[model samples]
Target: MSKRDYYEVLGVERGAEERTIKKAYKKLAMKYHPDRTQGDKGMEEKFKEAQEAHEILTDSRKRAAYDQYGHAGVDPNRGGGHGQGADFGDIFGDVFGDIFGGGRGRQSRARQGSDLRYNLEMSLEEAVRGKDVEIRVPTLVECDICHGSGAKKGSSPTTCPTCKGNGQVQMRQGFFAVQQTCPTCSGKGKIISDPCTPCRGQGRVEKTKTLSVKVPAGVDTGDRIRLTGEGEAGESGAPAGDLYVQVNIREHEIFARDGNNLYCEVPLGFATAALGGEIEVPTLDGKVKLKISQETQTGKMFRLRGKGVKSVRSGSIGDLMCKVVIETPVNLSTKQREMLEEFDASLGGGKHRPKEQGFFDGVKKFFDDLTK
Candidate 1:
């Protein structure tokens, strides 16, 4: 029986570009693949025809010949085969690799490894100032003994016999041909008759690798740093994956960070709040001097410029905000308690405390209005 035109089978014009032809074939292959249309003999036959059509159309030389003389131009018996076996591997790799997730497709087969994440715990000081840290990761590495070949010494992997090194086997149901991965070779298209003893025919081994990663200054919690090629090894000797170092800043004893700003509550003695004095404030680097103005109330804030964190991204420094909280004397001796009582008596019924005096005036007004 005479074969149908390759362009007609793929539903593309004869002048379609290689990319257009590939796109059309990929859609048809996905739609008519036996895995997708199981128990359907008619669709399976169309799938085979489509595959054969795509095989001829995608090749530059074969496409040229078929376009000029039709199927007779590339017939195997007419010496028009012109590397027909090579085309079968290309199609099998592209279609089934997607179905099984074993990494197929001519371009996608050599894909880089997957990215991995590592949560790193750090102190607030370390995150603000930045640090170089050494981390040990357990991952897969190429087997030294096998050199990533998965074969024993003095021997190499051979083409898979079950799939005839095409990595797929076609099943016939009546007039249909359905292609699937070869169970023997697992669709790798090659077989290791003599397996590597070290990697056990896998060509990779588990190893704990130590690496140094530099943490930039002012990296906050939830920030991530990408370390290139620091993840797991890829299959078939592909490139290694990336490693992401995630930052988790520990809670600070004295300060809380908000973006590049630092907030800290400075403990002030009652005397320091009452009488003007100088008090010491803590920063990430060292202690700084802060003035306590007379009659300074609790929750009063003071800004210390250029004394906060320097941002890693913006490179702009932020300010340190100091909030004053007056701490009452605790565990006082009898003499100290007597001194406080005398000081309280000197205030003369809250006359010297304007905030307390004004609060009582508002309270009296609120109740008088309620009564009216």
Candidate 2:
């Protein structure tokens, strides 16, 4: 029986590119693969024909000869038997991997190290001023005995015979090829028959490393500093990963922070609030004097310029806001009580307490309106 034309079998034009030919083959491979055909001989033969066409078209040299001489150029009895030497297993992997999921294309060793995070809590004082801190981290490091080869002293890892250093092996299920990690090498592409004493068969050992970190001023919670190559050691001598120092500022006792601004409540004596005087207010740097105005009431907000934190990003300073709370006098003596009563008698509600007078007047009008 005469063989069918390769392009006709793959359902592609003779002038199709290699990419188009591969796409056509992949579609047919999925539809007519032996495993999917359920023992249908005709579908199995169709899949084989598509495979032969793909193998010939993908190789630049073989494709040129086949295009020039037709089937005679690729006859097995002649010098065209190999037909570009493309591996059918690779073609199957490409088709099935896309149909199922990706990442099955190729495999390799020398995996990168895993990234690490360390949460460090600092006081508000320390976070504001900034300081250098030393931290100890327990992580995996390269084994000293075998130099990350996972072998005994004077010995090294050898290529995995099962996969020939490919780190992967193809499992065929009725011509449906699937790639999996080599069981013998565990995907490392190497085997260590003689295990290391310190790290056993693994390439890394657990050790505590001390590192110094400079905490910048104005760093708040959720801010992080990355230390390159300070994390867990990579497998088989790959570069180490990064260590992230996450900052968390603790709550302050006297002041609360909102962005770069600082807020604090200041207590004022009743006499001071009414008569006015100079009072000492606490700040991050030191105490500063704030002058109180005459007849100052509670809940008055006072602004202190440049008394708040400096922004790390913008380098701009914020203002300090003080909310005043008037404290009432306590534990009065008999003389003071007599003086207070006399003072209270001398004050008129309308003149001395205008706010209180207005409140009572509104209450009386509300009751009068209700009655009407």
Candidate 3:
């Protein structure tokens, strides 16, 4: 007969959480444990069924394979047994008193630690030019005392009597038995008689670790720097996690950045706009000469090549674009006002201002056409 769906056998939905999956398996296993039934063949089959279901669903890797390919993905007969056989003792040792066999299985192995994120604030200058910074992060590290064993010196943990070191228990339901984590050793199989003073039986301690992070040049807001093996320590001496440094660049005083480009607005004197001349303009490297042409108007843009930022991902440099705004004379002296009035009188008053001359010409034509 084909095997039952693992989720259906455990009485859990496909999206059930880790804790929920464990609870459902525990309830079904208790209802079908062989020890609870006396010489009943039906109960024995149910108990075995629950055990098989628990074996596949509890493990993350096995569960993923089962989800994608069903029983064929995990069945040993189908040549999918790259993983060793799942031990009932490992699953139900804590609860069932090691009915299968009490011992630490190879299923529990050292794994990498979790990853962490730290938001780092930077000035626009630092982001453009790059900088090095130090950060302090609080995380769990392997305990120095007892060498992460959670035991007193010269004394090691012993196998849990209740689980017989199997760390799981068997629950018998109405017609089935299922295996689950034994509550005795909490699935560790070994019992710590004397807990470590530092970590308090966890084999790890919470401490702040100082780390130096190098921010690369041209990195902008929302960019990230990944620090490998800098996250929280894993359980049972597993591998560590990675730490991510998130970049948040502060607003600049005079410039706005868009990708690799830089933008700035510059104010020009009226005389300078009327007559072309060279003036010094500010750039990241230093000041550069920018020429304003005669009759230059407000909102005129000038592009300075290779003055903008280079992208972190792509090394392409960009241009710095400057928008010019003409400033009219303000708070003119009495003599200056009189001189301006004399100059205005000398204009011949009609066609000297080309813009004004064109406007009147168009106005005269409009009225003449309307009259016709």
Candidate 4:
């Protein structure tokens, strides 16, 4: 019987791209696979048809000939086809390589080591100005005795006998082939006859290493500094991983930071707040004098430009905001209390304190309305 068109078998357009053809074939293969269909003859035929269509369309030469002259151009009987033999394993590998972790030929067993994280706590002053700190980390380092070979001196590792150094062993499972790591070599591809004493058979040793890290200026909490190749040593002489230093800013006693800005509460004497005087405010750099205006109320904010932290990423300096808190006089002497009473009596009720007067007036109005 005449065969169906390749594009029709895969349910793809005549001018479909290679990726589109592959996707269609994958869908059909998954639907008509013998394992899924349970030995149904009809589904088996459909699977073979889809597989054949994928083989021809994926090959540039065969696809070109098929495109120009249809199946007649690729038929082995017509003496115009490429080699008719196609490995079903290769086709499955191409479609499901990532899923099963098989295919892509042989891969090296030597893999990079795992990355590590270290939490570094810094004072606010140190974070703003930047500082170099020495930190000790306990991690896996390459064994000095065997030079990461896992073997004794004057002897080396040999290829795994069972897997022939392929690192993986293929297993046949009822029309499907799967690959798993070799049990004997543990996927290292090589076996050490004589193990190193320091690290045993592992090729790496657990030890403490001290490294100096330079903290960049204006780095806040949660910032990370990467030290390349400073993490755990890789297996079998592979490349080492990285060490990430995570910054955690310690809480400051007087200052609170938000983004690049700094906020601080400044307690001012009632006389200084009312009579308008200069007060010394603290900053990261040094104490700066801030002028308080006359009749300054509590909770008033004063901004000092460029006195805050500079952003590490943007390099933009921020302002420092000081919130004034009026402190009332406490523990007055008998004479002071008498003088304050006289002073309060001398001022007409509400002339000296407008805010206090306004609040009382509102309260009076609210009570009058309630009575009415």
Candidate 5:
């Protein structure tokens, strides 16, 4: 029987690009793979046909010949045909590597070191003004004794006999050829006959390293600063990872921060709040005198512009918000109590306390309406 047109087998257009052809083949291969089909003869044949079609269509020279002369130009059984058996290893490597962890020879894979995170605590003033901090981190570093070779000073690593330096071994499972990391070499592709004393045959050693990190101004909690190449050391001379310094601002006794804004509660004496006066308020910089308006109520907010923090990224300054709480006189002496009684008798008509009068009036009206 004559073979089906490669494009027809893969369900692609005659002029489809290589990528389109590969995509179609991947779909069909996944659907009809022997493992999924469970030994169905028809599905097995269809899978083979898709693989063969993909193999020919992806090769530029083979595709051009097939496009000009159809199957007759590329059929392996035909005289002067250019087609050869499809390489299962290459096919599965492209499609199933991520799924099965099998693919291209991983011989001498250079793994990148793992990134590390360090929590750095800072005071509000330190975060606002910025400071240089020293941190000690326990991480992996390249072995100096063997120079990261994992071998003794006088000896060197040799190729593994099991994988023959390929770093991978091939296993045949039914119709599929799988490539896996070599068990003996553990994917390093080499063996250390004489191990290093310091690192114990590993190319990296654990050590504590002290580094100086420059903290930028106006950095809030949860902000991060990156220090490159300060993390764990990579294996087999690979590139080292990075260290991220995570900022954690400690709570201040007098102030709370939200983004760039600073909030604080200011206590005012009842006499000062009612009579109006200038009071000293604390700020990150220094003490600032704030004017308290006459008859100022509790919970009144006073805003001090540009007294908060400037954003590190935007460079825009914020304001400090102070909420005042009126404090009443406590532990009155006999004279103070007598003066307070006389003061109460002097204001018997509730003329100075408009809020208190309005509240009592509302309460009386509610009771009168209920009685009616």
Candidate 6:
């Protein structure tokens, strides 16, 4: 027979939080506990079912896989086992430990610090050539005085006397054996009577730190550089999280970048466009000479091989594309204007202005078709 959904078995929503799932499972465990049932096989099976649901729902990786693939994801026989098989003693320790703040699994389940992101803006020149940058970040760091232990120098934490360091106390409520966090210790299992002065027993302190980050070449906007263990200090001295330096390239006045290629518009004189000549175009490296053919049209694109940005992924160089826009002469002298008018009249047969002639011809045909 097929199994029931874990969420349904626990009487909780699929998106229920860990604490809520734990609470629901605790209630079921209390109701169907074998100690209370006294050899009733039916209650034992129900108790096992609740244990299974609690185990799957509480684990992040197992929960994620179960959420996507159902029971097949966590089933060890089917090979989608992201779950570490639940143990009876360990599960009870967690049930009472985490739910009641017992801190029984503190050694094995120390939480990591939160990841952080810092946005860094760069110039095109700086991006093309990788550089090291200095940045200051405000975050939590392990207390220098306490060394993340929350205890005073030359002092150590002592085990709690209330629950005998089990972090929890078992109470007999009629037939039910109820487990709860030790009130005196607040579930820490240990106590730091003389706390660190700097961090005040928190084990971490807020401060600003300076760090140097090396940016790789050819990284575009939205690329990130990750520095491992550079984020805020972890709780109870666990491993720190990573810091992501997000890249945002400042807009360049001359060039636009596209996937290892650099693009720019070069202004061409009208005479230079009409007659073949060598002209200088700007590139990332420097200016390079480009030979323009006669009758070069505006918006003409020219590719300069191996003149663009180097690929960050492939270690290959790209090309630079120059687009030519013909610039009409302004503030012309009387003689220059006269010469241009004379030159314009000489091409009256319309052989030199193919685009202008074709536009007028198309307009004429459109009007004729409309009249018909």
lDDT digits (tens) for residues 1-372 of candidate 6: 346779899999755889999999999999999999998999999999999989999999988766544454565553222222222112211111122122234432235665555668899999989899999765567888888777889997788788878778899999999988778666657767887777666677767679999999988887989899887577567777677787878889999999989999999999899997999988877888999999999999999999999988898998999999999999999999999999999999767999999999999999999999
Mark the regions of model 3 whose C-alpha exceeds 4 Å error after superposition: 1-112, 159-168, 176-179, 342-372
**Root-mean-square deviation per candidate:** 20.1, 22.9, 18.0, 21.4, 21.3, 16.6
Global Cα lDDT for candidate 2? 0.76
lDDT, model 5, position 13: 78
Q: Identify the superior model by lDDT, candidate 4 or candidate 5.
A: 4
Q: What tens-digit string does per-residue lDDT give for candidate 1 at 160-227?
A: 88887777889898999998778887677788888887766766666768989999999998798988
TM accuracy, model 6? 0.66
Q: Over the full model, what C-alpha lDDT does candidate 5 score relative to the true structure?
A: 0.78
Task: State the displacement of the C-alpha of residue 256, model 2, in Å, after optimal TM-score superposition.
Answer: 1.1
Per-residue accuracy of model 2 over 1-372 as CA lDDT, tens digit each: 445768899999766888899999999999999999999999999999999989998988878766544453455443212233222212211211121122134335775555555668788888888889999765667888888777889888899999999989999999699999898876878888777776765777767689999988988876889999887676678877677787877779999988888999999998899899999999999999999999999999999999998887898888899999999889999999999889889985688888889999999999999999
lDDT of each: 0.75, 0.76, 0.73, 0.80, 0.78, 0.76
**Candidate 3: Cα lDDT at 225:** 95
Candidate 1, position 106, lDDT: 31
lDDT of 4 by residue, 1-372 (tens): 346778899988766899999999999999999999999999999999999999999999999766544453465553221222222122211221221122234354876665555668889999999999999876678889899888888899999999999889999999999999999886779888887766665677667689999999999987989999887677778887777787878889999999999999999998888799899999999999999999899999999999999999999999999999999899999999999899889987797899999999999999999999
Q: Point out the higher-scoring one by TM-score: 4 or 6.
A: 4
Q: Which residue pairs come into collision in candidate 1? A: none
Candidate 3 lDDT over 1-372, as tens digits, reads 345667888888766788998888788778878888876899889888888888888889988766543453455542221222222222211111111121233233233444555668888888998988999875567778877677777878888898788877788998999987777776777778877766666666667689999999999987979998777565556666667777877778889999999999999997798788988888898999998889788899999999999888889988999999888888999999999889889988676568889999999999999999
Clashes of 3: 36
What tens-digit string does per-residue lDDT give for candidate 5 at 1-372? Answer: 346778899998766888999999999999999999999999999999999999999999988766544443454543221223222223211221221122234234555555555668899999999999999876678889988777889999999999998889999999999999899877779888887877767777767689999999999987989988886676667777777787878889999999999999999998899899999999999999999999999999999999999999999999999999999899999999999899888988868899999999999999999999
Clash pairs, candidate 6, are: none
Runs in model 4 deviating more than 4 A are 1-108
